[model samples]
Target chain A: MPLIKGDQITEDPWVYADDEDELPSGDVVVHLERWEKDKDSLRSRNGKLGLILRSDQSPELVADDLAAFDLIALDFPAFKDGRAFSYARMLRERFAFEGEIRAVGDVHRDQLFFMHRCGFDAFEVENAAVLQDWLEAAREFTSVYQPALDAKQSVLRLRHHTKKAAE
Target chain B: MYRYDEFDRTIVDERVKQFRGQVARRVSGDLTEEQFRPLRLMNGLYLQLHAYMLRVAVPYGTLSSKQMRMLAHIARKYDKGYGHFTTRQNIQYNWPKLEEVPDLLADLATVEMHAIQTSGNCIRNVTSDQYAGVAAGEIEDPRVYCEIIRQWSTFHPEFSFLPRKFKIAVTASEDDRAAIRVHDIGIQLVKNAAGETGFRFFVGGGLGRTPVVGPEINSFVKKKDLLSYLEAILRVYNQLGRRDNLYKARIKILVRSVGTGEFAEMVDKEWQFIKDGKYDLPQDEIDRIKAYFAPPAYETLPATDATLKDKIEANADFAAWVKRNVAEHKVPGYGIVNISLKPIGGIPGDATAEQMEVVADLAEKYSFDEVRVTHEQNLVLPDVKKSDLFVVWEALSASDMGTSNLGTITDMISCPGLDYCNLANARSIPVAQRISERFADLSRQHDIGDLKVKISGCINACGHHHVGNIGILGVDKKGQEFYQITLGGSATEDASIGKILGPAFSYDEIVDAVEKVVDVYLEHRAPGEAFLGLVDRVGLDPFKEKLYAAH
Candidate 1:
């Protein structure tokens, strides 16, 4: 698997850990259940922690503990189930999580742009050969209509600015 | 009409470029049909039963003459020289090759139109009353808010993929011409006791498999909180709506399962977090959009045109046409003229390229360079003057666009069923044509008066059979086509789902069955009572007895 960040495919330092398997040493990502059950022991580990929330889980469940993790990964069980799009926005715009937001599971070239717009900075794609295609997908549109976590100025704001400048 | 600004133009141009690349990839076999389906659908291209069908959205049913001419161009160059105006205020070209769609879309973009969100499971084109700015006694122009929503929902990141396709309709007049009550989300503009204009929201109304009139969720959401409120509702639906079953994915099912009271509570809780945030519409932004929809320039003239009166009296045909096809305009000398696409025994909603060019010419010359596509599959010259009525009729008649049956029994709302739709189980257009031929006499149609006959090929109800006064659903009974009838339905302010009347009628029997139902209404109706009113006063018993007694 390859990870896309910004305009390039970068080396992924984080490793996903299964619940029954032994925890990896550094920069480990665990599921929500594992993180909730072993909170005390995981906090004592010598690594940066990350949490993966499923499509059915909301970001509000970990609102108070958002500062504990260096990354939050949202899962799309299927590409058509889009609950995680809203969850990614809530993690950035509402809870103000500044860590890495990763999109995992069923990530494809078609959805990379929307996932990027919804504040997903990293995507764990299945095929390493299509990394360049995924990167291009994430930059498909030069402008957008609605404001999201990205810094791109919305068209509405641009229209108002243009009118004001002419005035 | 709202003209595209610089930002709007840039976005549509980029969209066309992006889709061109996507179509290239699909042609080279780099992308499979499974992967390319949603991408093409998002741009409003569908692979129908015959060839590719391209649905071009007419935003809020408003069209400039230049845009109408462009539609005529597309029809002449790409399709089979015709287009179908749909129930959702869209125009669908029934035949276009896969390779030619990118060029077709580029042509549309040049006219400030693209087929965005017309077929995808995203927020569809926002619809409003066909008579939006010109309708008398409207609280405020609904197109202003409809355009606002159009900008906000176009390529919205968080809601591009939801549980199912979403539709939103807005209306400001007391008369619900836009059919707001049966949409996924219906917004009615209202003035409060303190004389403040706001929105009355209706959530989860739909007309598919299980038809339900959306219940009122909030009485009045202030003007500033409109976008925030809609975002809240979408957030709730995206998070909790069912995705496991395609039939149960609409918002109406979600509202029914959790109950409207509980659904509203969930939306209110979501609104608490983002109500007054950056999504709240600023007064300046609203004003900017509002400026585009200001009243067109008009010369002062008397209310009644004496020459028009004399023409109507001297010519009985013109009088009949005016009586059925014209509506009062807010401006004194202007009239809203409805040009029926349903000629006697012809296909409903099908307009030829020449007819489209004729309408474009008429709009440019007589009606402030504007036209409207009504939800009833008709075209509207929204601001024709009373004095120009005879000439407009003459032009339309020359083009074969004048049927003079605006709301009569023959002006039906039908779908491109088994003839062109893969999802259909039986044919719909042929049945509609038969019924139209049976009631081709204009005098008899006017005498019967204001009966809506909607037909669908399947239970998906794209034809809105559930809301028709006389609803007909075509079913496939063991590989044979059969039609089922329902009675006592209305899509107005007093909206209700029709109840099924008795058994199904075969292909040979459906037209006779419809005639019998109409005959029963004509035989036992109070004077001046509409078909829907008659159905409301007397239930389906009389219709059922006449329809089934011969067995």
Candidate 2:
């Protein structure tokens, strides 16, 4: 899998361990059930820690434990299933989770812009062919209407300032 | 007539660019059709039965003359010299090629219009009363809030891909001209006990395979918390709405499964977390948007126009048109003129490019450059002066746009059935045409007054047959086409889904069946009683007895 971060394709150092698989040594991401079952063991292990949540899994389940992990990967069971988009926004704006929110599973170039705006900073796509398109798609819109987790100024705020300046 | 500011202009231009790239990728085979369907639908492009149909959003049913002219241009250049004004108050061009859609969208964006969210499983184009600002005794103008919701829902990241499509409608008057009760989320502008204006919300009302009138979720929400509350409802639906079954995907189903009380509680709980956050609308923005909808300039004049009265006395045809098609305006000496698209024995909502150009000319000259599209598939000049009524009627009559059936039997709403839609089971336009021809006599139509006959080609109810006083739904029995009739549905403030009559009527018998139902109503009704009132007085038993007697 290739990872899209910012405008470039970068090496992904995180290893995804299946639910029944043995934990890898360095910077390993485990499923929610695995992390829940072996919380103490994984917490005491070496290297950085990460957790993966399925589309059905709510971020509120791990709200208290967000500080323990360095990354939270949200799964898009299907591109059409937009639960993770809400989960990502909740993690960033509601729970105030500062960890890296990565989007995995069925991620594509067309949805990358929306995914990024929903607070997913990194995406794991199936192919490297989509990296350039992903970069362009993420920067497709120069202005947006509503406030999101991203730091971009909304058009409403801009209009407010413009009104003040004219006054 | 809200002009696009720089921010609005930039967002629309960028969206066009983005869609152009998507279309290029699709055409070059980089993206497959399965992957491109949702993308195209989100931009209001649908692969219909014959060709690509492009639905252009007429925000809250409001249009300027410039925009109307551009629509005529698109109709002539891209489609078959005509366009269909839909029940959602939008216009659809039924025959544009896939590759030409980007340029069509570009042309639309130049005039501050686009087809964004006219389809797809996202928050669709916000609809409102066609008589929004001009209607007498309106609590407040609903377009300001509609514009607010439009901007908020456009490209919203969190809830773009929900379980199913969402629709929202707004109205500012007690008369529910916008049909808010059948929408997913209906907002009514009302005054609270303190004499302050706010919104009363109805959640999860829709007409589809399953028809349910949305229940009022809140009596009154403060002005500032409107978006926050809407966000709360969308978040709850996006997270919990059923996605496994396409038929059960609408918010109406979720609201039904959990009951309105529980659903309202869930929304309230969700709102507790985000109500005071960034989603709370600022007062300044509301004021700014409201400024665009302020009352236009007018000279002091009497309530009645002497020239109009004399002309009405001189010409019986003009008098009939005035009596049927004109509505009272809040301002004195002004009238709200309804332009009926359902001409005698013609396609119900179809308007030719010539008609569009004529309407644009009339709107520019007489109506202060504003036009409106109604959910009933009609057009309105919302601010026509009484003095200019004769001239406007003459111009419209010249273009074959004049009709004296505003709310009569011939003012029927029929969807583009098997003729254009792949989802239709039977042809609806022919049946509507037959019904119109049967009731072609204006005197007879006036006798059976204020009858709404809505026809849907299928159970999806795009023509809003579920809420029509006389509803017709087309079905396929084995290989042949059949029509099912429902009576006693009303889409006004008192909303209810129609009841189905006993059996199905074949293609040939459906029009006669409708006539029989009307005959029953006319015979049994007291003087001046409308169809729905008669049906309410005497339930479906009388209609069923009459309709099934021959069987």
Candidate 3:
């Protein structure tokens, strides 16, 4: 099933009609009403293990609360905020979370490589065709630097040390 | 003067090949500007306002006559027949196409030169006393340690990505000619109480929009622990420095935000783990590096140059050049010659391809073919046989490369500024040109001797304005460019940041204001006192009183 929109099944054993706006795909429905995204909801919620979080909320707090989740949806209210990049890296390197970190809004193909290097795995791009452009980011540079999210060397450190016999 | 062994030569050659590939890839669209930016910068290729500029490193500012001639030839052929020697002891060709850089690097490689780490957020070209081994001052040779640091820092795995670029300078003499205090990491080579050679470490010294004097982190760093202490500092900075804002990412900012005391503590903690680690310098390695800098054979001769003295006394121009450009050497009758890149009205660090070739040839003939780039953006032919000084000076004079404004007011450290740098607001070279013209009289320059004037186009102190005895910083109000003047800045052992006189001035008024500052110093100062010494005792009050008292 597509992670963006797949099904809406209630516990009443009834299948509801899907809305025009695709409902995010998940087996569990986490109703994180405004202020209720506390540690309890984070720790107790048990389903497809995908929970969406607001951008305004502290990703650091959410990262600490998160134990085992398959997907993290970090919302983007406006395009310019770069708090998410740090949050993603913090989750990936700091918290050692090995799950899909998705960037949901105000993102384009140009920010894909830097975004991915900062540890955003899958981009919730605007259109399906945008995915192709996002892939172009990987082709931009032949090497990586400083062991980013991708296991590679930084351009500055990309000196291919010619091998010599070890002492 | 470090000789390139087979390994070093191979490494430099391989570097050229890699940079060539990178250039080709960039031209073929395999690498975009963003992708190619770091690569080109690491190779010392910068695309400025007018065209591309290539900065060729002069390790410890040492070069030979053959190398100098090669530089001159390259300048005449590839560039605008001139090259600018930078404040960091390197020569820059102001115009070259991106495609031509590979061949340039290859040509330089033949002469044992490369521009590795001249830019980017890595440990930049290590600088030291331009008159390193030849200076009369006693202690140790600064280049030996500089070379050690070069080998250790080159492509160090953990330091490739830092918050910002780093610069390290060392000085061995009592006089701080290398401006060690103005570097990111400055080392003062000294022997300890027990007669053990070591270094005094200074961290966080830098000049930019925010000028700072580095603090002495360690009273003394054992010679063997130089690389480890540096690693500790870099580790602390890399992990903790602010990466969120580019402007505040420099180690200077980290040193500021963390508080030097706390930062020192952090570095101490890190040093505990790596203080005696793998990168320690051994006697063999030190000897190896020292072998590269071992002075050429010298022949003792008379100390007094009666003939040269007579010539200078007869010709006022030669006198002026000799008074400013000649430095004391340890050997009898030998002098270290500083080749002035700043001619009367020429661009400060610009050297022509032909001029480079000429310098190379001169190095081979007169000097030991080893040339050094001064931190003041001048070239030095260290270890010139005093007997051959007359001949070298004549050759230099014919080429107009013999301005002799070595420590004078006209030997300006100027940034590319608005003419080239993307970060600058006003043009620096034109102001520098006007000042040079104003001070063109050789007699007048001598009369007002031993002054350091530095100019920067913007707040980014690429010109190192904070250390200039007379400093000029250009700023923009609304959209128009205006220049500010400061006095009493010194970069020696008693380093202090320059103080602004008052309000900013029009471009035309700025030069006159500088003239006024000098005139004030000339009027009130006692005999034989240098500008910096005079500025120290009286403070900036006399100059400031006269300066701001203007309309």
Candidate 4:
């Protein structure tokens, strides 16, 4: 129930609304089925609504509802199931969703660096004891080579930039 | 030959530290084995049958003398004083303590090497033609693109955890030495109508339970768009590749289901968005990487050296070795020398630390200080001068490295089956040794020229048995080990999977059956026809009859 947002752990404000429970105040996260069923009622409430997507679920299906949510958390289910990493990137890069993208369920310290690079700014880690480990994991590598939604300057770009500066 | 810059060094060092911490956590009970398996696998470590095995990536099969010595050092210190070269052009140390892996990786990082992506479900070590830079008539150096792909695929955020492991092979020559047809994604550097170099893409080619040669997806993609196109393909596979069934998880399965035409269209449509985007490789970066692979310094000499001729004439063994182990290099007076790891009855790719150090010394002295690991599980000194071949031969002969069995029946590609691999159903090394001893005589092996007998302990095809000229696959028959034979498979330019030759034979009868098949080939062949050529000329019926005659 801990949320990591850009090197800092903060209290998770988003509450999951179960099928039988009423929608909570402030920001609330619900599954796709719940969002589909209570879209009108959730919009009429005073709080913003977000949807939790499984690895099998596609963000393209909810492209029209991007503007209505403050968070879109992609579920990993297992760390080996990497479909959410792609989903996060697709949400940010393709669908152009500008919200707090989070990684949920079975997130490990080893994957936080890549999770951030894939456009997931927030992580829902189960154990708060390993929060420091997770923060250190995000800074494991000083440079990367590939272009991603995170837009960190790559080593190749840095090399060229340094060479040009010297020139 | 690609030297690691400051950035490269830092990345590898950071990875080593991260893995070190992870290993410490795993050993101290902070992480469960299930939680640590993927992490260790990403660093190329696997818990085998007896002990932990660490697979070190020999990227593109290219290595410098310093790097080779480092591998040898790791073998001597961390392992059982020897390492097994895999069919993927990587090396595996069968015995290494889990705690010592970080230190081992740190030593590897000193030489700009790490084992990342060697065993994970990520894009595995990008393989290329073993003789990439020196091979004659190559369109361009394939390692350039292989290096590009290596960078793009390393720790890639989106495609790192794919449905299954992915493999990519690249070849710049007209003859596909890298087995471009049987990979998940194969790239052939070709010239288009405008006389500019581009890539011909092949998707869905793999060998396993179902062996299929990948079909061509795009005839030609421009050079500038290689990364974008490849990213498109990976994006499509990551989103739609089968996640429900492990057996049908490779991109090849997806390509088969969707059809190559439809897959190609999807890739093309995906390519539209990213074709001109940030992944487009810049010319300066390409030039920077290309500079690392420029031709090594060479002395000006005649095409054929007289000293080599004189030495060969004097020593009959040297002459025989020259006929088999030496290949033509692009540079005048230089030859590509294949040092056979398949000595008469030895393991296919096992090299002791002493033997490795000897090769490193020989490479430093004779071959421009460089070595290469071939997918055929042999070592290569790619720039040996023809005049220096005799000395190289003598040094190698001292260590039993010069067997004069390159590309012969004895020079087999074998996987570490049940002997070390936990996934194997039957043992593969003893069978390979039996076959090698059965055909040990140098003259006899030469007489049966260019016969590749690849053996795998299981159907995973780690030994590449599906593409061997005389393929032998180890199968378990009700707790007994039996072998299935496939004929006419060639991993060369004319890549084709061999057809099964009747029922499986017991281990005792497998070698004799192979001998019978060879006898049939020897009896019914035209002049200048190799074993593969002979099988092509005549169908598999004759060999099948001879093999299945008694049983």
lDDT per residue, candidate 2, B1-551, as tens digits? 68899889988999999999989989999889999998998989999998889999999999999999999999999989999999999999999998999999999999999988899899999999999999998988999999999999999988889999999999999999989999999999999889989999999999989998999999999999998999999999999999899999999999999999999999999899998878878999999999999989976789999999999999989999999999999999999999999999999989999999999999999999999999999999998999999999999999888899999999999999999999999999999999999999999998888999999999999988999999999999998999999898999999999998878999989988999899899899998888888888989988888888888
**Stronger candidate by lDDT (2 vs 3):** 2
Clashes of 3: 56
Query: Runs in model 4 with CA error above 4 Å?
Result: A19-26, A36-45
Which residue runs does candidate 2 get wrong by more than 4 Å?
A: none
TM-score of chain A of each: 0.95, 0.95, 0.67, 0.92
Query: Which candidate, 3 or 4, would have the higher TM-score against the true structure?
Result: 4
**CA RMSD for every model?**
1.2, 1.2, 7.4, 1.5
DockQ of each candidate relative to the true complex: 0.79, 0.83, 0.06, 0.73
Residues B61-96, model 3: lDDT tens digits: 767766777677677767877777788888888887
Clashing pairs in 1: none
Better lDDT candidate (3, 4): 4
Q: What is the fnat score of candidate 4?
A: 0.68
Best-to-worst DockQ order: 2, 1, 4, 3
lDDT of 2: 0.92
What is the DockQ score, from 0 to 1, of model 2? 0.83
Candidates 2 and 3: which is better by DockQ? 2
**CA lDDT, every model vs. true structure:** 0.92, 0.92, 0.74, 0.90
Model 3: runs farther than 4 Å from truth? A1-167, B309-316, B537-541, B548-550
